[model samples]
Target: MNTRDAKEILLLYRGTTDDSDPQFCAALDYAKSDPELGQWLREQTKCYDTIRTKLRGIEPPLGLSEKIVRSRPIPFPRIWSRVLQLAAAIVISASVTVLLMKWSERRNHSVAGAQEILVTGEVLDMTCYIAYNLSGPDHAECARVCIRNGLPVGIKAQDGKVYLLSGEPGHSVNAELADYAAKTVTIKGRQSVRDGFAQLQVEEIRKL
Candidate 1:
């Protein structure tokens, strides 16, 4: 299978499933031999682990929820009412922890450079591009609007590959991208991926 197909399949992969499925095995083997793909897999796994940890962390403290609902001989007095309040606090704390974990993930994803490579494609707002399966001049205006509203910008290469343009803490796409949105351009950059997200840290860009 092609890398893209492999990526799509592996995205939904579950660890509990057999590792011997031919297609998945092909993808897994390919990832082992391909640096970029391998890095993507590792990052994807990290993201998955993070999600699992967050979900497990939110599992209410043992018997907390059950106690809240369990029938009792008497209506909860103020002393018993404190248990309900404690449960609320536990939920709130769990929520805050999840938020902090997400913040930490984002912070850890700060984009970095890899080997420089040149690619040609149409600049796009990634979200709309994916949602609408669009490219070229007709979509530029919409792409521009999406980017301005804080959506990611990327290039969908002629080969049907997408390189997300993101970096630093704020973002990588600059005011200069306004002119290129949905327009074909050749760009040179050091590409990098973290948490299965790929990005191009542009060093040069010009209209094709």
Candidate 2:
């Protein structure tokens, strides 16, 4: 399977226990052999772990299930059965909404706390880089084309950290950076990280 296919399959992978499953096994094997895919897989797994930890920390309201059950008759009547189902659905929906709100708040808090950073790295188009591991001087022209076409831009730093680039509202840094594709450059920005993904709100960039 190709990296894209393997990535889709790996998304469903939970842990090493799934190693015995043939489909997951094949995808895992492919990722192991492909450095880019392997790095992506590791980052994905780390994000999953973080989400799981956050979920575990969320506690349900005391006796919520009991309260719901007690509100209905022990032997639910036929007419009330459907009503109970609807109530249960609403309760679940409300719980999920609250959880999502909390998650959003956490993400926003991270962004609010983002610090300014200056990094030197190669300018690259995120699309081809992530999909096919394309980068460097040989891929310069193609990277330029992709960036000009509106694909997301990123930088692969000397330490191997990759940060997705963003610009001020109503502006795109793509036009200015397109010509520098696959070339080393220094960038200054506010770095926001969430779920193992990093993004840079670009303030300054200079080709090195």
Candidate 3:
């Protein structure tokens, strides 16, 4: 084989290239007549010898061979049975672990879903203008109104006229109302609203 072909054969033998029966046979034939190819093959053989020598120097795990030899003779039937048993155990364990993880994730999600607070009363009152006179005030209704108006879930009316609300704590409602009138509200910030009659205005609301 030429240098390129010879190199390809060597690579294939070294597992760097895929195996091909025709290429392998052709390489063997070419090596007999080509001096350069013969030398390359010899070098590859030397590399393999070096690798084998290194591997031989590595100690096997303690008593592995001894234990294998000392173990009872494994008949075909018993060997197959043991293999099946091992496979079954592995499959069962993997399935159980996967099921447990799914169950745990579901349980955690359920608990988190349950713990999520629905904004109600004064908390809802401070985020938007509430014009509804609905008696059965619920989160669903609040969400609907807020979503429809692109308003924050900061306002709710238990009775009487709609009140402008905000989550700004310790801030006067009058100050917020003034800010709202100016249209100088910020769309992003943290604030707290203490209670009703205290007009707290949110200058901004931003998605978290």
Candidate 1 vs candidate 3: the TM-score winner is 1
Cα lDDT tens digits, model 3, 85-171, are 545543543343244323322321111112212222332312212222222233333333322222222333234333234333333
For candidate 2, report its TM-score.
0.47
User: On residues 1-208, what C-alpha lDDT tens digit does candidate 1 reach at each position?
Assistant: 7777666566544443537777678788877887877776665554344434444455667876567667554466756765675455445533433443343336435345367789898887664455435556755665565455334578888898888775445544546676788788898877776556566777788876
> Cα deviation in Å at residue 143, candidate 3?
72
- Candidate 3 residue-wise lDDT at 166: 36
Q: Please give the lDDT score at residue 135 for candidate 3.
A: 20
Model 1 alpha-carbon drift over 4 Å, by segment? 1-113, 167-171
C-alpha lDDT score of every prediction, in listed order: 0.61, 0.70, 0.38
Candidate 1, residue 9: lDDT: 61
lDDT of 2 by residue, 1-208 (tens): 8987786677556566567998798899899899988876775565335434444566779987678678974576656865675455435533433443243334333344579999899997775566446689866776776566445788999999998777775577888898999999999988987666587878899767
For model 2, what is the error of residue 139's alpha carbon versus the real structure, in angstroms, after optimal superposition? Answer: 0.4
Please report how far candidate 2 places residue 70 from its true position, in Å.
Answer: 64
C-alpha RMSD by candidate, in order: 17.9, 16.1, 28.8
Question: Best candidate per TM-score, number?
Answer: 2
